[model samples]
Target chain A: MGNPAFDILSILPFAVACSFGMLILLLEVFQRQTASRSYLAGIAVVGFLLTAFVSGSFLPTGTARATFGGMAWIDGYTQIFTSLFCLAGALTAMIAPRYLQEHGADRGEFYALLLFSVAGMIMMVAAADLVVFFVALEIMSIAVYALAAYTRRSKLSSEAGFKYFVLGAFASAILLYGIALVYGATGTTNLAAIGQAFGGDVARGATGDAAAMSTLAQNAIVAAARGADVSVAAVIGNTGAGAVPLAILGATLILIAFSFKIAAVPFHMWAPDAYTGAPTPVVGFMAAAVKAAGVAALFRVVSVALFSDSFRGGEYGWVQIFFALALLSMVVGNLVALVQGNIKRMLAYSSVAHAGYMLVAFTAVGFRGGDISMGSGLVFYLFAYTIATIGAFGVLSWLGSRGMPCDNFEDLDGVGYRYPWIGLAMSIFMLSAAGIPPAAGFIGKFLVFKSAVAASAAGGPGSGLLIFLVVTGILVSVAGVYYYLRVIVHLYMKKATREVPEMPYGAARWAIVICAVLTLALGVLPGKLVNSSEQAVGQMAGRADGVYQQSAEAPLPTPGGIRLIR
Target chain B: MAETIFFIVFALGALGFSAAVLIAKNPINSAVMLVCSFFCLAGIYVMLSATFMAVIQILVYAGAIMVLFIFVLMLLNIRDDEIEAPRLSIHQGIAILAGTGIFFTIALSIAAWSGSSSRVAHDTMSDTFGTVEPIGDQLITSYVLPFEMAAILLLVGIVGAVVVAKKRF
Candidate 1:
């Protein structure tokens, strides 16, 4: 391995974000009590821009290198998601200052906590080991817990924070138990090493060469035959039968934990209250960056560590689990969202529905030979959802004032006539969320469904299921149109029943305009981003194969009874 | 034979104390029973040859945490009559049934696996295994990333505690 000092370069984005976080906290200490703290958001935005720049610099090379002794990976997948999270964080910072001030809860620690949370998201997406992933997840989660309760004067905010903390801690405990079980089964926490012990190379060879025993397995057996190792046999043999149940159970638990983070159905009981009670800008960050981080973690753990021929199909497969979750989330989220009068709560349920749509792409990834396109589709869809959802929440925060919070559908009456720019931005976001044409969400849905159809055409065991899921998603999204349009109807047609005071626009207006424009731009011309997303997934898959090849070439048994290449 | 006897004693003590911790009416008695449970768990850790873990379990949980818990209990000085005894509801019944089902399922699975060839035999463990030195080395070396990240987590936790608990900023 190279010098450990060089590994710091791989985490430069995270370091930059953390340093800015600390700087903001320090600045908060020296500032006069009455002095405006708005510059903290400016500093936080600049920090995010620098982080995005550092992450984007890695995009051209798309090099897949494991750093931090294989505890983290520097690759296109990590770089892309890191930049996306930076964008989301910057937008949230831009939207936050005025909203916080309006509520008389303006504090410098808000920006610091936001920066720290973004730093955690960066580390989490790049994490290659379970330990790194878990720690980074806590770093993200704890900061968010504090941010949710940032406006401590409100009992609703305090209650939201308490509920999120309790549930999140429970989820973390379950996740840790899963990691422990997986380590017990595979003898290592390193994802690549776990892949090796899970007989991924053997399963891959079985698919290619049609061999009863893969050549790699033969090589391992031959090495054992020469008395080089006995544990190699135990590793290969046990994975074939004995440890499979434990491994599957662990994988299932991990999936459940991530589902909680992503707010999938059955595990989404906390989303509505948490979303509605938290500060609007913070909700934007949570809906966009936090959920994207969860999806990124799922992509790594499920696609790299647990991906095997056996794990992809059959009764206990993760694919089936995701299918059930996707179906339930889409139906329940959309149906529940229809009746909600509170715009924030509606968006919360809609976000759950969006999670279902992403899980559709996720389920497609598990099918044989569907990884690349489906993976790209999932990435693109997340970007689309992030921008639109953040924009929606930004507008909500923009409309709200100290005593008069604009949360209900009725609050938007005559808004289109009153503030044309905000009304237009809201319309664009609503259309995108509803997946109307000429908006980013439409293109995102098209890409995901098209990829699913293409995968089905490629003819796999679950081809029929894929087509059925696509059809179901399309039909359910039609119901989503009514609620989305209702916002526009209220915006344009209804008269203001009360004297809604006009609020001055600030940095939040810029964030909304940017999100609206980007949504349209991406929808109209998606070729460049689609290509880059495809390339990123290709590089990710290449890294997985490279790890498998490395393990295949050297089956050397370490004292831990597993071969780990650091 | 001696190891098995110790194992049985420690496991049974842990289970009994845990049950007592749950069932005890007085908050002080429950906290004390929780300490006893922690001590028994530490004993089991010692039997598993995780001496460092055993020591920390006793030192941290029994010594520090239990002391805090007892202090809180005493400070509160809550009367027994003031606290309503929790009546078993449908939710509680369902929770109990599900918990028992899961416990038995896991216990049975472990029993089956222990008798099977798939169970990894850890007879070849190095003498340095579970010791403080190697774990400390690992914390600085291969696990340095997580170790550093945990510092950030704790920082966030401290900040979170202040943000949530502080009366005024």
Candidate 2:
């Protein structure tokens, strides 16, 4: 509260991206109508690089601090995800210009919207309050909706944009309603306050007879005596045991909304159509940065707000819900992907399967003492998945031209012989995505599944469920190998029946090479990223207490539940 | 007792108009029905002592937004025959059933919880509670981050509107 300037500085990465977005829009207005706007892509890449640079500076510090009146966290997890998003944005920008130019849709606003969306993403992962999270999510979704329809001349693109906007808006409404319910039950949108209300130890500390006073009523008395707002105190006191059901419903709604965002099964009907119809590079961004942001926010909210003992492992636990989603997304995604002829649609399903894999790690987080490694594994998997997906889509955009989109498997026939470098890069991406040996995806899967196995080995009540999830994940991933390898087969073994058009190797080639090298490097020497991810998750665990002190200011009267940082 | 009567009247009006909005076949009629629903909602808000919210609800939603919606409906210039006849498809039937089930579940839960001892009496609130000043103060102070972010959200919305609607760059 004393340092508003520091709060502004804490959001430097978001500000930098927003400024660049505005700069691009302004530049677009001044440019001649007939002139090429490809340089705008370069400017956007530069913007992303600066954003990454600013975020990266925070990585080594390993500090977790709440800023902006406790609305956002400047923490290792935030920095890591922000940097990852910037990388995704930079790669997408590099891959976009040539594709956009080719499709006669090369407008500077594409890069502007890309920057605006990335800015939103940077904030989304960093948001500590549900209000900030919702607004940032809208900023990201709105920009992406427009980006999906950037090629408005095409009916498919327009349809994709309209469908995504409608579904996404509906999901946002559900999320807002959930937030409202949680606020009604807890009387605050601050995540830490909600966590304090949900935590079990505070309920035990009340002086009144345990049977007479509800846990929420006890906490509300303690909180009110500690100088909480009267309105908040009143709402919390009134809800009593009823608050639990309301909050649970709210959390479930929020989880459903996030599942839609991450393209989990039962809510993933939009992914195939949107990915197939969107411009290629935009698809790469959606598959990479957008999914990463969704997963990041999901982890934050689940860990900070809903990780109470009662909430983590019971009949109504999120772990059980995530386990079902993971199983369904993996099985259904892999199975549906096998039947898809369009490469983009295939990858879209593959992305769903990858989300399932991430959820496998997410489910492990609920097991006793499994959070650090499982959380780190989730991060590493996202990094691996983001780069590999973007690279795969980059290769598709590279091989495409004005008339031929190069979306089908046949379009890739004998591409290995025609363009060896692009083919090799595509092979590496495909290999990584399939979780094959000597590739990043393999290491990511290994880390995640290994943690799940280790958690199972600990022999808890839900250990058997964790083992089942891991086994099911591994089996479904084996099914996933067929479609991923099919791309490589088309690249090398098959002969082209229809001649594939050759496009110039532009900045997209460089982006592909970068992704390929990073994929292999992470696979071979994952020590740095693995250690950093662990450090990030560790910071997250340590920072939960910091959030309480920052928001509440006065020390919480409850003795046992929270370790106040101050 | 008077407050209870007002609450009942506004609540029933809001729900009835909302259902009418859905049932109206003409696009213009539906738009007007929606406007009526908004006014009833604003009345409820005012009864809850949220004068600022009620005023803004009427101004932004009922007055301005409804006008724009009506303008668009007029511009589209659709005849009554152009509207699809209400048909109970299986999907629509299932959706309606699910909606009713959820509504009843929530209503029952609220009804059960209403008997709890800790209900906040309306007189407990401060005189300035729901006025604009306190809201503006909260918006600029603790909630400033989201307030600023909302501006960015609006900017993005505007940009998105132009990007999707513009025929040519």
Candidate 3:
């Protein structure tokens, strides 16, 4: 307990960022006696970049280890997601000071809140215990709730904040209830313990119809058996209870909560309003980082915790649900976006469609009979998605003045001529978002779709659906190009009428350029990213040996943690 | 036996107060009842053996938060008088619909799959409920953030109360 983060010192970068954020707050508060707050801003940026590099080093080969007495865990999956979070945080922090200072809302707390949120997200991915997970989620959420309404006088910002908070609370409540039920079913709040519960089913021949589960189940039972139980039969009964429908309900409720985060269809009511109403820089943060974390968490929880033939009692039915969600999201998001006049709203819908593409990667992750593959592809896709989205939002933010808000198609009428680099970077972002080649988004979609095609050839339960997914992926992408190009059409195709009010060429320009470069870099060299993903998939599947295992960071109280056994 | 009684009482109290809060038209009354609801929740904590949390609930939520609320009401002293009416605004409608959708989805979905076998047979008395010592030990060691939130909450409470209490300082 001396250093709670010591067990997973690999995640020290996240902690350091959090500390840097606090220091930024303190530095700004006392900077009246010293030089400019810009110095502190530079320090924050440098700290984050160093942290980003350190985390990136971990990405070459995913290392799965637990830290802080099993409270926080850093494995291959956590490594990839944490890297994504850090990069997004770094990008947002880079531009935030100048952008916020331009409008007079430039407080040190803004950076602190952003850093804290990133810290929250990092812990979220690494959380081995329910308490830690929930706390991490809250820390991230509360910060953003304020950020969404940062523009106090703007009625839209206020309304957006209200809508997001209320809906977010409701979803959080549902998620908590799900956690309670999962704890009830498994008796252990520890993920490692929960995974082992699946092994228990394999013990009593509860493998249902999936013979492929035998190996995972055997390994899980062996791993779970290593941990002493206060009540053996209770543990077995809970394991046996996996055959019950409550497990599915728990998984579904959790899914519903995550779907909201990813802005997936049906649960995506909050995203457009929140995105459109928020200030542009905050919108960039939401579109890129918040949404990425949501999807990453969904990937971690659904794949690692639920989604098994034995656990769900032969109901590995998310293949169709994901298929439908992907199709519906692509169709609905792209279609609605085509008619949208607001540029930010259009990008929000584009973000939704991007979620669909990622879902395709997730769908391809598990084989029909249940072997997993192309996990690294999903990570690469996320990395691409994060870079491109943040880049798009940054351009939009720069174009938007405090009064104008840069939302409508007309806002960018002559923006391309005024800010040529921004125009090109935004075009690249739009192209990448549309899945055009030579950008990260293109390669990401390619790997995801290729894996889906492979998954289909393997003759999973829904080859027909995978085929459908593949077709819609192409068709939906065509729709995506239309909306993305509409902005391009406004930018270069149309001529500027009024003088484009230009700010000093400083931080925003640099951020957009860096984002554009990263997008291109990721597009060209995605091997390391994919390898990270591969390691992550192993850790996620590694827990399949036993659902949840206790590590140093988060140790489960024998009776308190696992209620299914009680 | 004790736990069963505690569960029954706490469950009833939680449901009843929540319902009252929902139905009550008076904003002031609603706020007061909400405080009561929090107290009842603190009672449930005693049953769960989280004594420190029980004290925290009554002192912070029931005592401090409620008084601050009352003070604001008196300070404003709206001419509209003792009974504050509730509005069925769009937010309320959205809230109701959302709550209903979630409740139906969860309740009906679980109901459909509830196999007729009730496998819930355990000796509640025999189970050694986690004592405050362990809870404290765990909170300090593993849950330091949430524990630190006590200070944040106090800070927020003081700041928020002051901000609201003084129109402009």
Candidate 4:
């Protein structure tokens, strides 16, 4: 019953964040009521910095391994995402003290919940088992729900919390059900096992592919193919036809669940209200870190389980579903954002559009074996998005007070001239978000678009789809310019409507300056970062083959009460 | 013939109780009907020879959860007339259509997969696998992490309840 100390080292970042959170929560009770809350913020900042350092240290030097009986993984992908989440958490912590003081909701649990949620996000990225992933997702979601309602004084905050909880629970149920069905088909919940279950000739010998398989399986596969506009007859004619039906059905269910998490077009309805109603710093955390975790999970799950080699080059595939979702999200998100009056809501729609761009990159990976640069592009884009968004929200948090939050377009009128520093930073964020030159967002978008073009020009089976997405994505990004430029115009041209105190700030101001500088720096000198990102992705590509080798050596449990004795 | 009759009775009872829970205007009636439905579900579980699951179902769903439901219902003291029937609208109509479509699609998909060798066979179960002792052993051994996580989740639930329901710390 002793602890597995050696194995636990792989999860050092998660452990650090969780223990730091518990320490903060315990100290909150013993500390004097009159004590400055900034100390707690300082602890959170240290925790995040330490976690980021640990994650960075563990980045793949050329190896990838799953520990804890395949429940968690240590790899370059996990390292990159872990660092991003911790950095986001740190930045949010820096902004929270000022925002909470102005809003009259300063409490220790706020920082505790933020750290706990960051731990959950790190765990999510490291998860190698479906159950671990589900647990981590729930932990993150529950803390966020609590944080959303942290302000007891505001009815809007409570409403936002309740709505998000109800919708999130519904989505979680759908996702768990999908996991159950997949477990049913594959007889295992381990990502590698599920991947092996459906890949190549191995699937024919899998438990579910026996001659006694029901005709209904064929019917469902046909229905799925028809739904995706693929030829059902051609798919049924293939070898391992019996396994395809269940894989298709399970993947569809999982795709639906992931769509909600990523806030794709139709599932994005709750995002605006959730973002606008929460405290500004929490909104930034959710917008940046939460979105990063979701995207990472999507990539891991799709590549590790759902898109095995046998499922490729098929008449029907999950890629087509993702392609459709990405196309709709880009078109709808950009178009609707143009009319939003609330800054938070506009940013929410923009987040959805950004998810679309990432999905386009993800779908393109289905073509040409696996595009390492495209995958790395996704990581880079998310990092850029996180910094810019946190900065934008930080500026909003700075300008707002308890009674009169500067949320609307008119609220920001002439404030730019009044606070030149904040105005210039906000302008930089707006430019980055619009994919304008000399900004990180532009570089991010260029890399993603370039990947899509590479996939289409590679002349694969799904090249046409990638081509269409790339074209539409580029055009929609141009439309994204309109709303972003409008923010700039309002900041500079409009007259100031109200007078506000111009007081020197502490941590929040410093945080905003750091974010802006990083955004600009990454844009101006992208070489080193881009090279690291591609290297991380290269490590990922090599790791897939490594996983198969490891699984071969391990004793694998098969379906039908069969076990391999090594 | 006897097995078929038994299955039909259990299915009908469960479905009827579920329908009653949905249709009952009063919250108390709905709670009662839900308890009845849980019993029927436990019966179905027993029919599948998952005796441990059936016992847990009765203990957790029918007993403990129902008591909590009744406690909340009594505490709220909502008036009977306040629970009015929802009027049919375009939104409702579309929801119904979508629900039916999704249900049929899932049912068809499940039927196809089940007909194949994918149907998990309970007939081959090891005697100890379904028994209480082995289940307990496995819960403490292989599933110890999940069990501990569940304990933490319950603790969180308690803390959250205290934080939200209390007017002041």
Q: Against the true structure, what is each candidate's TM-score?
A: 0.92, 0.93, 0.84, 0.89
Which is better, 1 or 4, measured by TM-score? 1
lDDT of all predictions: 0.79, 0.81, 0.68, 0.74
Ordering by DockQ: 2, 1, 4, 3
Compared with the true structure, the alpha-carbon lDDT of candidate 1 equals 0.79
Question: On a 0 to 100 scale, what is the lDDT of residue A168 in model 2?
Answer: 92
Candidate 3 local lDDT, B1-169, one digit each (tens): 9888888988788889878987876657878888878988999988765567888889999999989998887777756465567668999999999889878866764564344223435553234334455456556655564455334333333332332233221
Which prediction has more favorable DockQ, 3 or 4?
Answer: 4
Give the clashing pairs for model 1: none
Among these predictions, the greatest DockQ belongs to 2
Put down candidate 4 lDDT per residue, A35-84, tens digits, no spaces: 66777999999999999898777544555665654566677778878888
Q: How many residue pairs clash in each candidate?
A: 0, 0, 32, 5
Q: Please, what are the lDDT tens digits per residue for candidate 1 over residues A334-357?
A: 989999999999999999999999
Q: Per-candidate DockQ versus the true complex?
A: 0.45, 0.48, 0.24, 0.30
Candidate 1: docking tier = acceptable
Pairs clashing in candidate 4?
A213-B116, A214-B115, A214-B116, A216-B112, A217-B112
Which predicted model would earn the best lDDT?
A: 2
List runs of model 2 lying over 4 Å from the truth. Answer: A1-6, A58-60, A201-232, A369-372, A497-505, A541-566
Which segments of model 4 are wrong by more than 4 Å? A1-6, A58-60, A200-244, A369-373, A498-505, A541-566, B1-6, B118-123, B136-163
